[model samples]
Target: MRVVILCGGESSERDVSLASGSSVARALLERGHDVVLVDPAAAVPVLAGPLRPGDVVDRIAVGKEPPSSSGRERLRSRMHAALTGGPVLELLRGAELVFLALHGGWGEDGHVQALLEMAGVRFTGAGSAACAAAWHKGRAQAVLGAAGVPVAERVLWRPAADEVPQGVKRLVAAGPVVAKPVADGSSVSVHRVDSLPQLAQLAAEVRSGEVEMLVEPFLPGREFTVAVIGDEVLPVVEIELTTPVFDYAAKYQPGAVSEVCPARIPAEFAGRMQELARRAHQALGFGSAAYSRTDFRCDPSGEPMCLETNALPGLTAGSLVPRAAAGAGWTYPDLIQRLVDLSTR
Candidate 1:
C-alpha cells in the first residue's frame, strides 16, 4: 500500500509528531509500502520530504509551521483542509492510505477525524466523537464512570475569572493532588501537587484558553498504562520515573525515565486492568474504530484506578503505543498498517 503519514502540528506535541511520522514512514517502507511523510501544518514554500522507512532512495525532511491566525475553529478548518491535502491530495498523491500521527488539541480531538470523514479518506485512530470524549479527561471520566468503569475521584473545573472553587480547594485538603487539563493528552498540563497552595497556583496557570483544570487526589501507588487493541490488551506498561513526577517533559524527553512493558504486576491484576481499559474505550463510544490506551495508578492490592484514555495514542518513535504494539509481536510498520486497516473497516 502506498501511504502518507501526517505528523507535526502547532500543538506542543509537534516535535513528538514529527519524530513519529519519520519513524512510521521508515517502518512502512520496510514493509514494502511506498510512503511519504507530510506535515499537516504546511502551507506556503511547499515543504518537501522523503518520509517513511525502507526506501533505497533519499528522504525528504518533514516541516510544519504553526497557524498564526485568529480563532481555534478557523485554525481547525485550515488544519482540516491542510490535513486532507497533506495526506490524500498533497503528501501521498499516489498513495492509497494515510497514517495519522497527530497529537493533542485539534489534531486528535476529532477535528482531524471530522475533516477526514468529510474528505472520505481513510486514516487511523478513533472517530470524531470518541476522539473528543477521550481527549477530554473530565468528559471521558464521566462517561466511563457512568458506564460502571472505575475512575479516579476528581473535580473538573473551568476557572471562573481565573479562580478555583472552594469545593476544589477542599478536595485537595489532605495534600497530594494532580492538577491537569481536563481535555489534554500526552501528560501535558499534568502537575503533581504536594500542598494546597501549590495546587491552587498550578490550577491558576493551567486554566488558560478553553482548557479547564482537573483537580484530583493523587494516587500514590504504582503507575501503569494498558494498551488496548481490538478488544485485547497488548500488555500493561509500567512507568518508572526517576524524578519525583512524570510531567510532559518526562513523557517525551529522552533519559527522563524508562518504561517496563508486561509490567511487573500480578497476572490477575493485569487482566483486570485490561478489562477496565476495554470497557472504558467502549463506554466512550470508541466501538472498535481503531485503538486506545488507558492510563491508571494502581494500589498494591490490585485495584486499578482509571486516569484517562488516549483514543489517539501517541506513535512517536518511543511512544507507549509502539511499545505495546511491539510486545504484541507487531513491528512499527505492522502497527501503522493495522491502524489503517482497522480504520477503513
Candidate 2:
C-alpha cells in the first residue's frame, strides 16, 4: 500500500512527531511500500537522499509562515494541501492510507483525523471523537471509570481568577498532588506540588485562565504502559525514568530512561493492566484505531491503577509503543501496516 505519513504539527510535541515520522517512513519503505514523510514544521525542507527510497518516497512539508498568522486555518491549509491539494501533492497522490505520526493538539487531538475523514480519506489510528476524548486526561479518566476501569482518585480544577486560591486549598488535601494542564500532552507543564504553597504559586500563574490543572494524589508504584492494537494487547512496558516518572524529556531522549517489556511485574498484575487498557480503548469509542498505550502505576500491593490513555502513542525509534510492538515480533513497518489494516474499517 502507498502510505503517506503526516507528521510534525505545531504542538509542543512537534519534535517527537518528527522522530516518529522518520522511523515510520523507514519501516514502511522496508516493508516494500511507497512511503512519503512530511514534516510540517520543517515545511519546505530539502530532500537530500534518494527521492524514492527504491520503493516510493517523497519529502513534503508546509512552507513556514509567520507566527502572527499561524492560526488553525493557516495550519489546516498547509496540512490539507499536503494531504489533498497543493502543487507538490505528490505525497498524497495514489496513497492508500495516511499513517499519522503527528502528536499533540492538531494531530493527536482528532483535528487532523477529522479533516481526513471529511476528505473521505482513510487514515491510520483513532477517529476524531476518540482522539479528542482521550486527549483530555480528566474526561478520559471519568469515561474509563464509568466503564468499570480502576483509576486514581482525581479532582480536576478548571482555573478561574477569583477562585484560584480556594481551588488550591481543596487540592492541598490531596497530598502530593500532581498538578497538570487539562488538555496538554507530553507533560509540558506538569508540576508535582508537595504542599499548599506550591499550589498557590501555580494557581497565580494561571492568570490568563488558559491553564486548567488536574490535581490528584501521586500514586506510588512502578510505572508501566500497555499497548493495545485492535483487540490485541501487545505487552506491558515498564517505564523506568532516570529522574522520576516518565515525563516529556524521558519519553523522547535516549539514556534518560529504559522500558522493559513484558513488565517485570507479576503475571496477575500484568494481566489486569492489559485488561484495563482494553476497557479504556473500548470506552473511548476508538473505532478502527491502529493502537493506543494505556499508562498505569502499580503500588507495592501489585494492584494496577490506570493513569491515562494515549490515543496516539509515539512511533519514533525507541518509543514505548514501537518497543512493545517489536517485543511482539513485529518490526516498524509490520506494525505500521497492521495499524493501517486496523484503520481500514
Candidate 3:
C-alpha cells in the first residue's frame, strides 16, 4: 500500500508530528509499504526520503519549545496555497491511504479531515465531525457527560465576549483549577490555578488572544490514558510526571516524565477506565473501528474522570497510544499496520 503520512503542520505540535511521521514512515517502509512523508505546512509539500534504522531517534528531536510563531502567518499562507490545489493535493489524491500523523492544528482539528473527505481520500483516525467534536475540550466533555461517561466539571468561557464565568471564579476561589484553550492539544498553555489572581491573569491573556477557554477543577490523582482501536481498549498507561504539570516540555522531552504501560493499578480500576475510554470515544461519534486515546485523572475518591478524547492521538515512538498498544502485545510496526487495516476496512 502506498501511504502518505501527513505531519508537521503549522501548529504548536509540529515537532512532535514530524517525529511521529518519521517513525511511522520508517515502520511502514520496514513492512515493505511505500510511504511518502508530506508536511502540508512545507512550502513544497514533498518530504519523501529513505529511512535508516534509528533515523527518527537520531535526527528528529522535538525542541523544548515549539517552533517560533515569528513567520507563521506567511507559512500558513504558503500552506494554504499548497494544500488547496497543487502537488500536495495531487499527492494526497494519489495515495492508497493517508495516515494522519498530525496533531493539534488544522490538521487534527477536522479542517484537513473535511478536505480529505471532500476529495474522497481515505485517511486514518476519526472522521471530520468526530475530530471537531473531540478536539474541543469543552465540547468533548459535554458529549462525554451526556453519554454517562464520568468527566470533570468544566465551565466554558469566551473571553472576548463574556467575562469569566461565575462558576469558574467560584471554582478558582475554592481550590486549584485548570485553565486551557478549549481547542488545543499537547498540553500547550494548560495551567493550574490556585488563586483568583492567577486565574484572572490567564483569562486576561486569553482575552487578548484566543476566544475560548475551559476552566475545570484540577484532579490530584494518578494520570492514566487508554487507547482504543477498533472497539478494543488497549491496556492503560500511567503517566508519572516529574514536574508539577505535564506541560508541552514534559510531554515530548525525553526523560522529562515516565510512562508505565499496563499501569500498576487494581484490575477493576483499570477495567473501569478502559470502559470509560471506550465510551468517551463512541460518545464523540468515532467509527466502530476508529482509533482514539482518552486521558483520565482520578478524583479524590480515586474515580477516574475523563479529561478529553484525542481523535488523532500522537503516534510518536513514546506516545501513550503506542505504549498501551505495546502492553497489548503489538509491536510498533504492528500497531501502524493495524491502524491502516482499520482505516481501509
Top-TM-score structure, candidate number: 3
Q: Model 3, stretches more than 4 Å misplaced? A: 50-58
Estimated TM-score for each candidate = 0.86, 0.86, 0.94
lDDT (10s digit) by residue, model 3, range 179-268: 888888899888899998887777677676655888899988889999999878999999998776788989988899999989999999
Candidate 2 Cα lDDT to native: 0.73
Instruction: Count clashing residue pairs per candidate.
Output: 8, 1, 0
lDDT of each: 0.71, 0.73, 0.85
Count clashing residue pairs in model 2: 1
lDDT of 2 by residue, 30-129 (tens): 7676666666545562122222446544333222221222354565566655555563354444568777888887798888778777777778888888
Model 2 — which ten-residue stretch has the worst lDDT? 60-69
* Order of candidate numbers by lDDT, starting with the best: 3, 2, 1
Greater-lDDT candidate between 2 and 3: 3
Tens digit of per-residue lDDT, candidate 1, span 1-345? 767777766566666666777677677777777666666565541233443443553333322322232444544555666656543365544557767777777778888788777767677777788888787777788888898778777887776455667767776776677887777666765777787678657656644556677888777777888887765568888998876556767786666788988788788888888888888878887776578888888644656788888876777657888888887788887887777767667
Candidate 1 is scored at a TM of 0.86
